[model samples]
Target: MIGRWHGLVIDCPDPQALAGFYEKLLGMIRVQDEPGWVVIGDAPDRPGVALARVEAWQPPKWPDESSNMHFDVRVDDRETAGEKVLELGARRLEGGGETFDVYADPAGHPFCLVAW
Candidate 1:
């Protein structure tokens, strides 16, 4: 293999809040939390994500323009998962096909709940 995947890094206004949202959303544990940085993972050795705070962050309006990155979470039940995410402060985004539903996190990052 070329190299191991480390983790996804997300930029947001409040790293803690954004990380907390993902923690609840994905059941990922918070491994480390600093003032402007938050790390989350499923296990001690495995890779996860680091949420870093960025000043004057602007949320991308997906569909209007191409998103630099996006998350795709697989779920057994799409409708139920969508509802749960919506309850967790995700705004519904347009252009979700039959296989998946799109939403924007509290930080305005786009993510999808995939039934496939």
Candidate 2:
């Protein structure tokens, strides 16, 4: 059986941009960086975000199409993180108030900020 989740691979138009957003929002660091690929992690060992630079990346049709997957980023300050992600160019999608805030990255990849 699977013990734990290692990481999640995200398809985006810009890996660097998406990775950068996650890095700032989650306070994660780039554990690995290469052409066409980037990985971010909370610590030196635990992986969090794995990003791929796709040339033909097409964002999922929002509020209509079914998303194959999505991510939830738990944070201490939902408001702060939401503002921070917005400043980083992420678009607000759903959820708000004191509980959580959902946002879509620059490439339209959705993620959530949950109060920690």
Candidate 3:
């Protein structure tokens, strides 16, 4: 590879809040915190998730053909993970089955909790 992967950056109206949600969901610590940017990861040197503040940001609508991407998180127990995410401001979406469940984060970004 020509370069190393840094992290996945998500755009939202509030970087702090969105980063906090992912930090708890992924059991990561905050690596960098700033006015418009926040990052969380296992450690400072490792690849992590970054949240960038975007003004006039519009959330993607679920089931819309124009929506491009989402995150799939692997977990040990779907039921437990589902409950936890719901408690953390995530709302369940329409599509899902025995092995996975879809949810929209507080900012309306879709992600999945898949059982391993």
Task: List all candidate RMSDs to the true structure.
Answer: 1.1, 2.4, 1.2
TM-score (C-alpha) between model 3 and the true structure: 0.93
Model 1 regions lying over 4 Å from their true place: none
The clash count for each model shown is 0, 0, 0
* Candidate 2 lDDT, 21-63, residue by residue in tens: 8788777899899889999997758857899988999887665
What lDDT tens digits, residue by residue, belong to model 1 across residues 1-116? 99999888999999988888899889999988899999999985789999999999999877897778999999999999988988888889988998998899999999999987
Residue range with the least summed lDDT across 10 consecutive positions in model 1: 60-69
Could you tell me the lDDT of residue 41 within candidate 1? Answer: 98
| Better-scoring candidate (lDDT), 2 or 3 | 3
lDDT rank, highest first? 3, 1, 2
RMSD of 1: 1.1
